[model samples]
Target: MLTTGNDTVLSKRATKTANTDEFLLTQFEKAEANLFHAKDNPEGIVNMGTAVNRVMEVELIERLTKPDALRFEQRYMHYFNNSGLLELRQAVADTLTRHLAPDNPVSPDNLAIMNGAGSCLDALAYTLCDPGDVVLTPTPVYTRIFTDIEERGQVDVMPIVCKAVPDNAEESFRLYKETVEDKILETQSAGRRVRALILVNPNNPLGDIYPPGLLLDIMKICAKYAIHFISNELYSLSIFDEDANFQSVLSFKDIPDPERTHFIWSMSKDFALAGFRTGVIHTCSSSVMKCLGKIALYQCTPSLIQHASATLLSDKAWCDDFYLKINRQRLRDRYSCCLARFRGAGITVRKAKAGLFIWFDLGPYLRSRTKEDEMDLFQEILKRGVYIVPGTQLYCEEPGWFRASFAVSEVELEEGLKRIQQVVEERKQKGQVSWSTY
Candidate 1:
């Protein structure tokens, strides 16, 4: 038996968190890490890095926290439901069915509700992967996927590198179906089992939606290899572009392998209720559902939250007409505002259609086409009173790309844009030119 003294004797998984980017960010010495807290800190940190829907708070709050929100009869609830309340699960199932699978009814029995999507991913990771199993995902993804899937699960997350499209007309860092299969085959040849592939629809950082055909092709590839395909449609209803088509994996008429295909969604992104901490996992495999149910005990959302979320989701008319519609319009307006500002400043921002952020090329500002230069630029902007996540942190192959959230209050967004403009001007005056060759 190992001596359980200090953290030095902790499990390897626990020790891994010590060196994680989350840990490093919390330990930043320049300022208190809780700079975003409104209370004690009079000096506000302009947060353009956090991936959240900060567009409409009053409406969401009013809608979710009304007097009838929580069933008062449920106040005495003290028992644990590992798979969550059937009512909540039913609500989610109904909502999903209404949105993505109107033809086929989504059974509540096939769903498992947990605390937020991050925890759901963590549970799924353990349910499917072993200590050395591999999970493939695209580059410049939401960084937390690494922490959620690998920290405890001990899964190796390999990036499927995508080359940047030189032409403005083409999408950047495009994910090809063939490349995914090739990568899986390559990983197998190297003697590691590819247990899973993660697809973030309306992708984080990129904010682009995958066409339905592409999603089906990818699902077929996963089906062929008998690997788990985890589709995180967290921002499914957050589509801001009128022309962009957003298709949930459930929208497929014929699922390639219902047992292998799974999906995750959360109130955190779509409903702008990260505080509620509600996540749902839908799987057709009864065995997978059993595995998830067993593990979900450790990651269950509170009964109160579950009840409240159920009440919120069950109101389909309000969600469709008021909340989702308003949310999309706000996101569109904010995205347009940010896009116009960047273009006005001659910054080449990859056009985004959905999600809360824009992947912008800061190659022009980097002193050299290097990660170090990227960090230098990042630090300079942070000092100028704005926070944006550098692409290096998101595991992008190339440096000088940055993920910036346009989902902020108008005042805050303008302030952040001003600070960014200042930094860009400062860099330009100092002779920093676009290193397109990188």
Candidate 2:
């Protein structure tokens, strides 16, 4: 028997979970319950908090529903490979080889397919570390990774706080090799084992892609400490910036620790198929692959979904030649539109080169630069029928930073921005300084 702060709890594990922060999820549920549908429910909540790509929904549905696209066979009705259907794994491997690892062709044998990226993270956490072991990632990141690694694996995530340098607004929230090594050593010295270091390349919330040089340096540090390196390159194809050089870890010719390095990706983001529930892990380590095989029974993707995913990936004419190119252009267009609106509203936003959302500074809207003030502003925006993620949920040390997804329908995007602008105007009328004035 256990009790939480509210004094109503059952099991010890339930109390532990109840004590964890779930504000973002709670808001998401509320937003979903009353979603804004332009012609249906215009006054309902316009969701910009969730990182989903709805801009290409029509294109995806059209292609996926083609006659030959998802033909059902007897194989679909029977149990297949628990890891992934061979055809799907090979298709995934081939796609990665062509795009991410041109130099080193990815092998299907090294791939483990799971239900989704969240499940992949959970599986990796369980396989790579024991309960209470630490996995380090830089902040502020996708907040869900904290629970994905912790809830089932009982592992802990230690954030290497990467605060932006004061007085230099132009500088990005940079993660240094020294900072990472120091944190790793400090954690180990404290009698706790640091088993892995996970990074979301082309980072979430920030929407900045890491440099190749920095990635190499970080890998060397992980190798020096003999810890696993997991790169969540979920947005590898979401790079809309023409000049941005996005490199995959698999492309590196010389890996310091090939056996310990792993890559994660999913159809949810790149292909705009969140409902598909398909994710893959590419790892060279035989031991890790073996462990993942045993765990796949619980989290394996369904055969029919795997077949459809394979068909989509196999069609180079549609996938490589058409879908990706158009998706990137659409992403660029939506991002540009969202940016212009925010700038026009006298708000300051960090320009994003990749990913679905934009990180912007709303510090001027707050009465004080505090988390409480940030939440108050968030609630105010929510009251205006718009939902954007507050920085506090992302473990951001700084207050008044928020994320809003631009990967939505033009109408929804405009409506969300309009509501946000209304909030800003209301706050301004009440004496809050405009972001542009700063």
Candidate 3:
């Protein structure tokens, strides 16, 4: 008989996932059970942990419910393309060409549409690597990547742990070419094959974009090692900083390993359409595309939903002229408000240029600089009716760091911050050790 860490009996195959530490989902369940609403349940929990942008909900509803947006057709009710509708893929290609790659226009034939970014990653894992092969990604990242790659694919994620320097908090967790190569060599020396490297641009939690030169250098390294390079541009259209120089890998003309490089994007973050369950993958390799096609039936999006998505994406007037421009402004405003609130609460936050969340330090509130203490503070804040993710769950080697989304409504954001402030003040009054002393 096999059992997980919580002592639930299961088959050997099932125990593999059951034994893994997926605490984020557990916390999310708790948060969802008591979600806060302005008039309905003001005393309920405020979820700051999930990376969802709720600011554009009304706008999305308005556009999606229009006459031509989601019109039903008889053909849509029958089986069509299992990979994706040609209409939707072409629309995605056109949209990516306009925003991401001006020089190299994207081709619809190279794309594979899935339910979401998680499905894309899972499919890539299955196609690119065999069981027991390693995929490298820098930490602290979105924690779900671990299970996404490993759960059913039976692959392992090797973390290229990037530490935060005390003197340069702005450049904290920055991934360097040297560090990447070193980790690759180290993993090879251990007799493990490194099949791929994943780069999250306009990174989640950190929210910093990689410079083009660095990207080129890393791509060259992947070429040298004959490994796959995956560029996850999930937050491509969410850049709020006027000075942010975000260049998608799709924009690069001379990719060192074009055949081995892949790009991923989704409507979830940028368009505030997480419920849409639409994700796109663009790869130049025909072999990879062939492999993906065989599995597309298992992860394909509904034809009706694909039609609606195409309608929204193909409308250049609405998407480019109004929605995107207004969305960026709203994200900028919300980010500014959240940053000010955290700083005013006497907490230290890492300045971010993009993404829905902010990575801030709760070191001052910890009794000691340890993950246990970090989680203690997390539970205390949750008890006060606010839920935020602790950094340890994201494979952050250091303690006392946390990520919280500011994409909620203004009222919810204020209430969540107030609860956090109450927890901090309570800790301080009880004479907890500050960051300086710790």
lDDT of 1 by residue, 1-438 (tens): 346565467667665676555822542333345464435553456788877788989887787668867656645368766998987899998888887778787889989988899998898999989999999998778888887898889898898987666545156688889899999999999999999999999899899888899999999999999999999999988999999888888778798988899999998998889988999999989999999889888888988888888888888888888888899999999999998999899888888889999788888778777988898898888887778888888888778888888998887788788889999998889888665655
Best-to-worst order by lDDT is 3, 2, 1
Using TM-score as the yardstick, the better of models 1 and 3 is: 3
Predictions ranked by TM-score, top down? 3, 2, 1
- Per TM-score, the best of the predicted structures is 3
Q: Which 10 consecutive positions of candidate 2 have the poorest summed lDDT?
A: 164-173
For model 3, where is the 10-residue window of minimal lDDT?
429-438
RMSD score of candidate 1 (Å): 2.7
In model 3, the clashing pairs are: none
Summed backbone clashes in each candidate are 0, 0, 0
The segments of candidate 2 whose C-alpha lies over 4 angstroms from its true place after superposition are: 1-11, 18-21, 434-438
**TM-score on alpha carbons, each prediction:** 0.94, 0.95, 0.96
Q: Each model's C-alpha lDDT?
A: 0.85, 0.90, 0.90
- Put down candidate 2 lDDT per residue, 1-438, tens digits, no spaces: 555696766665677787776877888899999999999999999999988898878988898899776788887888777889999999999999998889899999999999999999999999999999999999989998999999989999999988855434447577889999999999999999999999999899888889999999999999999999999999998999999988999899999999999999999999988888999999999999999999999998988889899999999999998999988999999999988988888777877889999888888889887888888899999999999999878988888889999898889999999999988888889898534322
Candidate 3, 1-438: lDDT as tens digits: 545686758765587776665787888888899899989988899999998899888999999999988899899889877779999999999999999998899999999999999999999999999999999999999988888998888899999999987745687898999999999999999999999999999898798889999999999999999999999999989999999999999999999999999999998999888888999999999999999998988998999999999999999999998989988888899889888988888888889999898888888789887989999899889989999999988888878889999889989998998899888888888999566532
lDDT of 2 at 111: 97
Off by over 4 Å in 3: 1-11, 18-21, 436-438
The TM-score, computed over Cα atoms with residue i paired to residue i, of candidate 2 is: 0.95
RMSD of each: 2.7, 2.8, 2.6
